[model samples]
Target: MPLTKEDVAGIADYARIALTPEELDEMTAYMNDAIDLLEPIRQYDLEGVEPTFHPIGDLSNVMAGDVPDTSVRALPLDAALRNAGSSRDRCFRVPSILGDQGGDR
Candidate 1:
């Protein structure tokens, strides 16, 4: 799991990022050290450990206090589309995510 400079460089390229030589060396060392720390963690023998999946110790008020407001209300289908930039068959129309050339499908 010792990551090399070439591995770091390839990662940067795949992520569409540019990194200086100094940054590349730093990233490689940091990642290799992280992997070394994780290597010992994977060897733990947890055959009878009960799962405590939730992180919350107490179910206290985790959300903001509700406040009354006149601004929020359910809107009729047609009323909701009043200010839409564009629509087709009463549905909002947006540009395709894969661009004008069409998707791989």
Candidate 2:
């Protein structure tokens, strides 16, 4: 059935939207047009068509194989920390924004 202005307005009100009169009329027309377009598809005879995951038959996944990359090697602790501008107790040391927030520096 085609949607009326009242239907559109009710739906907008239920959805907690504040639509102007022009917008409500436009939405009503849009909904009615959509219903008209879908009216022809209501008489299809696909009684035995099996439910399908993919629309095309026998489609394989295009994903790359899940394997750990071995080309890049892990860095040693010292090597990782070598480029740090400042580090303390094997961790980064940044300038304290909040003075004595945690404890005595």
* Clash count of each predicted structure: 0, 0
Q: Compose the digit string of candidate 1's lDDT tens values, residues 1-105.
A: 577899989999999889999999889989888888898777999899776756775566787767756588857778878889877776887777776775422
Task: Evaluate model 2: give its TM-score.
Answer: 0.46
Query: What TM-score would every model get versus the actual structure?
Result: 0.41, 0.46
Candidate 1 wrong stretches, greater than 4 Å: 45-105
Give per-residue CA lDDT, model 2, range 1-105, as digits (tens): 688899999999999998999999889988888888887787787799887887786878877888856787867768878888888778767778887687635
**TM-score for candidate 1, residues paired by index:** 0.41
Model 1 Cα shift for residue 58 (angstroms) = 23
How far off is model 1, as Cα RMSD? 11.5
lDDT of 2 at 81: 84
Task: Give the number of the best model, judged by lDDT.
Answer: 2
Off by over 4 Å in 2: 31-72, 94-105
In candidate 2, which residue pairs clash?
none
